[model samples]
Target: MTRSATLDVLIVGGGIAGLGLAGYLARQGCEPTVVEQATEWRSSGYGIGLWSDGLAVLDELDCLGAVRQRAADPNRIEIRATGGERLRQTTIPPDRTLLLAVHRADLHAALRTAVPADWIRMGTTPARIRERRGGVDVTFDDGRTETFDLVVGADGIHSTVREQCFTEWTLRDLDTYVWSLWVEEDVDVGGDMVSVWGPGSEGFVARVGDRVGVNLAARLESAPEPPALDELRTLADAVDWQRPALLEETDEEPFFDRVREVTCERWRTDRVALVGDAAHALHPIAGMGASLALQDARVLAQELATTRPERVSTALDRFEARRRKPVEREKRKARVEAAVTFVESEPLRRLRNGVVEHTPILDLFVRQQAISG
Candidate 1:
């Protein structure tokens, strides 16, 4: 491909979305600079299930092999009652394409390696995004200012870019709190993902390569807030099978956060645009968050690559139009998944479990998330 003239692009956040976009834009002859507020790039999560759609994006970026080398098979997911009684089992649909479970840090490292290190400016973030006539002038936290042809906000849920550009967008709390941690030592998790359902709470254990990841979710009657790790252990003590041991062995500090979904009136305007979690943060129940974000990076790069600098706004519109419907659908389905996972009443939980086991519902969901994400 012939290189086009440089269209100075500034990408906020050095996460997957930003790095992926930077790699793609650089290939398209854009001098893209990524600014991350952290002293170094980092993410708080254990294993992530990368469906075929997500792998396809990585494949396009030529990083699938690297990620696959460190990934594990997400072959089966089991749902069980708090007492360890098996409720349902869903076999991930067979596909020619790969479905992988990988540590978030491994995936991040893969994407980071794809981009030039000098292109990333760690410990730097825009304190102000001043909109110019046809571009944006960003004032960095270090008191440096620069103008760019386009500014892409791949920042996360509490995005400063979104706050500056799309002030109308709001993060809608799902009244859920989550705690996730990884075991320091390898645990024999049998290469399958398990979710244990309890009253107002749910716990999950997934095999991430040699190690195991434990995550807990609770539905709160009031606003969501992070609970202490000991409180998490107390809650996990009621769960079945190896969950208690898994929780106990997680010696590291757990990742705690409120579950939130972003509602944006528009994903882009003027010279500014939002992608990934900054544009739409879905409930984690769906397991499509990273997949969708990588998809956003690919689509955004595709749009910008084909359009001229003067027509950037049109490209942004096309990007949003193509992504919004599928994402909204995922969000809707995610809500249902959350409701079932966090069901409080025993009778309702039994009913939900029965429906999931006896019906083709799970297979369809699995296919949709794998193929459509």
Candidate 2:
């Protein structure tokens, strides 16, 4: 049954960012209702890396055990030159388990499984929201209205809330577009995870349970593929698959994703606030998009946990202040990483690889990740 017209929180978006913050808030003595644009909850997207920082959030939510059981460590990462000239291997050591590569759906399922179904109403979306002295009034697509003490915008890169609150800031296009698909193969991929090389192309594949999940994307100027999975699969196949030619002779219905980095100037407006990808979507090449989302949820919840119900926005402001720096730092890292990408020269690649392998730079980079960890 629905509670009173007023609630402590109304979360917009049912993706990981939304559901996670909702779950975390619910555990923090706040009743949160989640509104998802999707008709029903389903995990039908490409895979993502669940790094240690995000896993720390899952650990708090008590949902980590479920995700851990269904995921693989994929601790071994193999990087090979396009001509097979040099190979570099990196491993997550016994003392430090850096991340677990997981499908987006599985991560979503694990997070949702812990939240009460009644708290989340699928197919509910906000048409408009008004903030007054008492609270915020939220209007839904079904012509219904509800008031809440606070609203959390976890809607993603194209957040409608951001449009409403702080639309003045421009989300600059990074001159690069990304796409991915999940493929299955009977044979092992030689390494647990492989980042293959090609001229102006790069891709990675890891064993997601029994099936193999692959994600590939290159710089595209125009509409590279139709905004659908089947069409994007064609684009996925168009890229250079330098990963030992496993999919060259297979017919599979693979999951696909078209990616773009989301940047924004404003994250909080009055009583309603943005978190996770809604606040900022970083470039996917950094492999930290999912990590950032999870971190946003975790930090936002921590800030709210200690504040009174009436002071939620103040907590959100705190969340914005603490998050902006670390997130911007990662964005800068992604820009540098994406600018060079896999297209540069062999000498350049060797120079970059050698720096990562033989110098303290890589260790410092790892320590930066440890900041969030």
Best by lDDT: 1
Clashing pairs for model 1 are none
The candidate scoring highest on TM-score is 1
Q: How far is 33's C-alpha from truth in model 2 (Å)?
A: 0.6
Clashing pairs in 2: 43-105, 262-281
TM-score of 2: 0.87
Model 1 ranges off by over 4 Å: 1-4, 92-98, 184-186, 221-227
Candidate 2, residues 308-327, lDDT tens digits: the string is 65676677789999999989
Alpha-carbon TM-score of each model against the true structure = 0.94, 0.87
lDDT of 2 at 364: 56
The Cα local distance difference test for each model comes to 0.81, 0.71
lDDT of 1 by residue, 77-194 (tens): 7777777777677775445544687778899999887799988899989999998787799999999999988899999898999999876788887778888888867776543878
